[model samples]
Target: MTVSDEDLAIVAEQLGRAPRGVRAVAARCPSGHPAVVRTSPRLEDGTPFPTLYYLTCSRLNSYVSRLEGAGLMKEMTDRLATDEQLAERYRFAHESYLAERDAIEPLGTTVTAGGMPDRVKCLHVHVAHSLAAGPGVNPFGDEALEQLAQWWPSGECASKVKN
Candidate 1:
């Protein structure tokens, strides 16, 4: 099997959630593709359970792992540092980046203060808004951020932010 397919198999073996498919009723649209869609593990009446509970749970974990290493925090924080305070800036940047405050609850009703995708998503929002000052935009330095981006996942994880 392909690398991602093999990895997905491993995740399936581990999470064991509900059937992992993206359909209209199941998801927002079966034929239509929805970005960043997450299915709940509940029945129609919200009383029963799903076939596989691993689907959503495993996907969530994968998202976190991928995003965490993407240097989302480091990259954003890089804009706000001086040559001397690069290290300290990035440290602060990483901490705030991982400190998400817009996470949805398990029930998908309320937003959590420090929920999953909070750090990554929130941090990205801050970056998009350009909320920091120039040369001192982020707390991290350019070199440190470059190192992080090189070392971490270089996929869309560090790109998108669902503000």
Candidate 2:
């Protein structure tokens, strides 16, 4: 589904409140639709640090292609300040892009033009707890991890796809 500019703007605005310093960029697709490039900063106490971000351009390849065609990717790339987490996420995205490119056409499989896998989109979660429950507290909390475990399905994506 195509996201509208208003929706993207709302999403980006909401991202400003993320607990771990997350942010997003609202960009226009070639079809004049909207998408977001979300970034999460890895920081302790507001110092500049590593970060991770995902480009949610599910149908915006034409726009991205045009940007690339105009040689803007290089300029944009130069302007970005990267760190370990950002680099890691970029590596993951690049690998995924290459894999999707190689698997397309010959495999007769369908994927979004913007490179996101069809299985999942728009994942966000938050967790909060008090560091001191009382004078004497159990720092290692319970139940939270179990709850998270219950939330996700267990298994490899390949196995699920094969099934």
Model 1, backbone clash pairs (residues 3+ apart or across chains), number: 22
TM-score of every prediction relative to native: 0.22, 0.21
Q: Write the per-residue lDDT of candidate 1 for residues 100-155, one digit (tens) a residue.
A: 21121133333221221223233322221122222353432232233334442233
Worst 10 residues of 1 by lDDT: 26-35
Model 2 regions more than 4 Å off:
1-75, 79-81, 105-163
Clashing pairs in 2: none
- Predictions in order: lDDT: 0.31, 0.30
